[model samples]
Target: MSRVDLKVVLLGNAMVGKTSLMERYVHDSFNCNRPYQNTIGTVFAAKRVQVNDVTLIMGIWDTAGSEKYDAMTRTYYRGAKAAIVCYDITKSSTFQRAKHWVRELRSIEENCKVYLCATKKDLCDEGFVSDDPDIQNVVERYASGTQTKLFVTSSKTGENVVELFDEIIQDFISNPENLQKVEEAIVLSKKTGERYCCAI
Candidate 1:
């Protein structure tokens, strides 16, 4: 089987469940009671998936969301093929921060496929908080404008995590032109001496 590699980044504000979503999707496991530690710079994980006739190795970079690490985290965005911009459904500020992340990603990697993720759906379902229409509209507008998809996910319940990645892989596989763009970006970044944040 021929193997293709794609780089993906997770960007959002602190404590917005970026790591949780990543862990759930990559490992098919969730730890609700696990002690939370802010990601220092970036965490790397890889999973191989089959998309149509292609075997894709998704190289995922779980970036630190703290402003203190913004300089460091921004470096990982270069040449990324896709990005998942996550926000806590219960926190309005996180959603705002997610928008900023989306803008930053677009500025840095314009061709990168972006996915706006409203995370912690289980908490939203439990009455901790309800979705705000204004925020929903903002995300919807961004998704529509960017020509991408929006997902409401719950790491605790494993909702939409797998489906999100599945759609991403399928989208890439089906779009040969975009896949070529991703490959070209990787080659150009390498030629320009850009650091590779995640291994393929």
Candidate 2:
């Protein structure tokens, strides 16, 4: 089987469920009773996914959301293939923070693909995410303007969790050039003995 490596980073405000989302996606488990704990600088988890003949090994990095770590968080963005900017659906402030992250990621990593993720979807029983005027405006006017796709996910219920990651993997594999670029980078890294992960 052919192997493809992808580095993905999660960026968002504190308590927006970045850790929970990562756990649910990587481990397929959710700790509902777990106390809130801050991610110190960055934490990583790898999950291998099979799409057709290619094996996708995604190195997902979860960064601390506190403002104090803003400087350090940007360091994790280097060489990232994709970024998931997360926001809590129930909190407008978190969405605003998500926007900032999107902009920052775009500004820094111009080649990186961005996905806007709305977390805690299970908490919102009102209607679809589009029903929220503020979120809809941001999704359409702001997120769409950046060519970002939005996913409404609930880590608690496992809703849209697998679909979200599947879509990401598909996007990477759908393009022949994307896979070529990854292969070329791996070759170059090996030749130069360069370290891509945890070098910061």
Candidate 3:
């Protein structure tokens, strides 16, 4: 089978469950009772999945969400094929931070697919119900305006975690135009002597 490689980044504020999401998707396992510790810089994981006749190796980066590591995190955004900007459904502030993550990803990687991920769905009894209409409005508006996919996922419950990555991979496989754009971007970056985070 033909082999392809892609980079995916997860971004959000601290305690937004970015690490848990990555762990769940990459390993199909998560520890619900684990103590929370801030990601100092970034963590990397790799997973391989077959889409059609192609074997895709995804290099997933779980970036640090704290302000101290913001500079370090920005370096990993370049040349990513997809970005998951995650937020805690129970915390409106994380949702707002997710928006900022989206903007940052766009500014650095224009052609990268951005996914608005509402994390920790298990905590919400009704699965992402928000009392604030403005929060919903902002999330919907931003996603629509940016033409990004939005997903509600729970790392603890394994809800939609695999589905999210599968959807992204399938979308790329189905859309030749998008795949071409990503390839062109990679070539352009190489020609300009710019380094892609997951270049290999």
Candidate 4:
């Protein structure tokens, strides 16, 4: 099978469920009883996905959302091929913070494909999120302005999680330039004897 390696990063504010989303996607399971704990640094997980005849090993990086790790989190943005900027549907504030992450990613990784994800869809369905009309307005406006794809996901139900990563992999395959960049980065890292974070 043809093989390719891709780097994807998850970014958002604390409690936006970035970690849970990663777990659900990578492990196909979610822990409802798991206690809340701050992700201190970054967690890396890889899954091999078969898209047609190509095998894509996605190295996903889940970064800490605490403000204390803002600098450290930004460091991981260096060579990401795609970034899933997530927010909680129930909290409009999380969506606001998500915008900031998107801006940072655009500035740092101009070529990176960004997906604006609203998390906790189940909460929204259960009327947990307040009637924040402004939130929808803002989300629509911001996503349009940035020309980013938007996805509503529920980690608890495993909704849209697989589709999200599969779309990313398909995008990588469809874009020759993206594939070339990853290959170039690998070659350069080999020469320097360093680990290559795939080129953004």
What's the TM-score of every candidate structure?
0.83, 0.83, 0.81, 0.86
Better of 1 and 4 by lDDT: 4
Q: Write down the RMSD of candidate 4 (Cα, Å).
A: 4.8
Per-residue accuracy of model 2 over 1-200 as CA lDDT, tens digit each: 22338888999998889899988988889999999888989998887766675545688899999999999999998888889999888777888889898878778898788999989888775464533557646666776677789898999988998888888888887779877876676576667886432210
Model 2 C-alpha RMSD to native:
5.0
lDDT values for all models: 0.81, 0.81, 0.80, 0.83
For candidate 3, write residues 1-200 as lDDT tens digits. Answer: 22236788999999999999988887778996789999888998877666655445678889999878888888998888899999887788888788888887778788788999988878775556665546656777778898989988899999999899988888666768756755665566557875333222
RMSD of each: 5.4, 5.0, 6.0, 4.8
Write candidate 4's Cα lDDT for 1-200 as tens digits: 22237889999988889999999988888999999888889988777766665445688899999889999998887888899999888788888789898988888899789999888998878767545756867897889988998888999999998888878888877898766665675576567776433222
Per-prediction tally of clashes = 0, 0, 0, 0
RMSD of 3: 6.0
Which order, best to worst by TM-score?
4, 2, 1, 3
Residue pairs with backbone atoms closer than 3 Å in model 4 (clashes): none
Preferred candidate (TM-score higher): 3 or 4? 4
For TM-score, the strongest prediction is 4
Instruction: Report the error of model 2 at residue 187, Å.
Output: 8.9
Q: Candidate 3: which pairs clash?
A: none
Stretches of candidate 3 exceeding 4 Å from the true structure: 1-4, 126-134, 175-200
- How displaced is residue 13 in candidate 4, in Å? 0.5
